[model samples]
Target: MAKCDACGTTILFGGKRMGDQRYCNDTCAGQGVLLNRVRQIPDGDVVAFANQVHSGNCPKCSGQGPVDVRDSYQVWSAILFTRWKSTPHILCRRCGVKAQAGDLAISAVAGWWGFPWGLLMTPVQVGRNIWSMAVAHNPNQPSDALLRQARLILAQRSLQDGRSQG
Candidate 1:
């Protein structure tokens, strides 16, 4: 027997589950995702960034968003044994194209530079990143809550950039 996670109702039949989920219907599944996204946000800088986003300013560059939501996807193949991550921060319009380019560049360097492993891992990992970037979508007139999520991401990148520079 499964129980609806959202409403806590006992699910006698017609229940559904996806990735450790138990739900009575589609509506509950949607609610579960929203709640999960909120819960996944960690503390510390994200809290600070969320506050900043709720206000008028951008938490990242403070450059004001119309901001792009960058989604970085990582793939590791134990057989081919290559790990790659690529990031491209741009205006919402160009983010997709830039992400694709960055992924290809990173994958190629990791693969060819590494020789055998690069040849094996580069193709699949590059393909995965390309697909993800192609599907990436940033909402129009992003809500404050969504901006807060983006803020957390961008702030982390900024810190990384600073560390790498100095």
Candidate 2:
């Protein structure tokens, strides 16, 4: 007898069992394996940037400005996935415009594919991004630690560049 990892069901009747499959069912198995995208990606800069931008601070210079907020997300999987989602973002008007342009550029590139999948996906994503930008004004200030880290990174890069040039 094995206990299902997800639902705590006692598995005593199924003969199609081999080894200790912590999850007693397929649904449980899928739920157990599927993870948050950010955690899966584990990119420090991406996470940090997301945090900074959504903090109601200017994303580029981290200064004060007329606040704007946008939420957009895209989910992509090689083998049948939801394909797109929503992400929240905050930025100044200038940064918002820049973000819109960048998103539009990405959508344009995808649209260039001009075929079944790309055609479908690009239009959907483009509309979503457009809406995200249009609705963008909304949060807390970023943590001091994050700001300090950015400053340190910039200082380190400048030091290395100076040394290399000299």
Task: For each candidate in turn, give its C-alpha RMSD to the true structure in angstroms.
Answer: 12.2, 12.4
Scored by lDDT, model 1 comes in at 0.58
- TM-score per candidate: 0.37, 0.39
| Model 2 misplaced stretches (Cα beyond 4 Å) | 1-56, 65-69, 72-90, 138-166
Write one digit per residue (lDDT tens) for candidate 1, span 90-154.
Answer: 34435445656666666655555444666656786677667756764544454444556665465
Candidate 1 has what TM-score?
A: 0.37
Worst window of 10 by summed lDDT in candidate 1: 50-59
Candidate 2 per-residue C-alpha lDDT over 26-67 given as tens digits, one digit per residue, 9 for 90 to 100: 776644433222233334664465465445557566777544
